[model samples]
Target: MRFKIIFPTGYQVADILNDNIDINVVLENGDVFFGTLFTISNLDYLLAISQEPFFYASDLLIVKDLSKKNIRAAIESLVSGSIELAFTKIRSTWSNESGSDSFDTIIDMC
Candidate 1:
């Protein structure tokens, strides 16, 4: 799945671009997507009436809703910058181990 969020102002866009902030997408399901994906300047000029900067996360895993605790854990792991570690733990239990091997795989997925 591909998800995108628009920054209403230039300040927000500049901060995201300059700081190279990692985007963490916690779906309603347990699956989490984390990546640095905001370099394009004119990705959606026509779609955005204001032409604000848009961040798009692609190739995310699709799953059902997760428990509240699991959602919190996913958020914590992504924010802590231990995505690989988190995925390593999750992959052991996750049926689709093929998708959650390394950070490079995560990047490629995103």
Candidate 2:
């Protein structure tokens, strides 16, 4: 089974599994960086979006909403400058690990 996952903006990251998905990140500083992804929960992700040396869940511009609790925890972890904690909180809620993972991948190859 294949389905489309689209962000609020037109930007889309295809094949978001552990497989490196090609996506462009526009940082808060207006600098655009291009790369394939690891786990989006990785610290590299926080670094990509944040202009600050210390990163947070609030630092994330794109969010994967699972539950209100998950979103709140993600922000709180960032507010505390714990990117790993933020990752842990958000990682649990990522849809890929849930029902989505059971399906065959669907993606646009950039």
Candidate 3:
């Protein structure tokens, strides 16, 4: 099943997903971070740990239609360590912006 993850006003694409929940983050700028969901909060917070660093409460996207399949896929990806591989394949396919790279970067990174 397909699920739509929505971001709050100030939330970034990288902020979503926890280290315990197997998930792949697909950024608008084509940057993918693979990890598991370590914590999920009702206040639109998700804490995840990846190979690089630990994600905090402020770094998460709110998923509107959280579905079982989506969650399952995320878990599977995390367990298999395929999140990075999947991201590499999808990142390049993401369209690039023409405007201010810094602004775009900031927006996407948020």
Encode model 2's per-residue lDDT on 1-106: one tens digit a residue.
1112322234333433222233332222222223322345545655767888875433233334323343334344443463333222222222332454322332
Count the clashes in each prediction: 0, 2, 15
Q: How much is 95 displaced in model 1, in angstroms? A: 19
Task: Provide C-alpha RMSD values for all models, in order.
Answer: 13.7, 15.0, 14.2
True lDDT of residue 76, candidate 2? 41
TM-score between candidate 1 and the true structure: 0.23
Which residue pairs show collisions in model 1? none
**Global local distance difference test of model 3:** 0.36
The best-first sequence of candidates by TM-score reads 1, 3, 2
Alpha-carbon TM-score of each model against the true structure: 0.23, 0.22, 0.22
lDDT of each: 0.34, 0.34, 0.36
Clashing residue pairs in candidate 2 are 56-78, 57-78
lDDT string for model 1 (26-80, tens) is 3323445444333233334323655556544442221122323333443454545
What are the per-residue Cα lDDT tens digits for candidate 3 across 17-85? 432333444444444444333334433232232443554432233332234445555434443564443
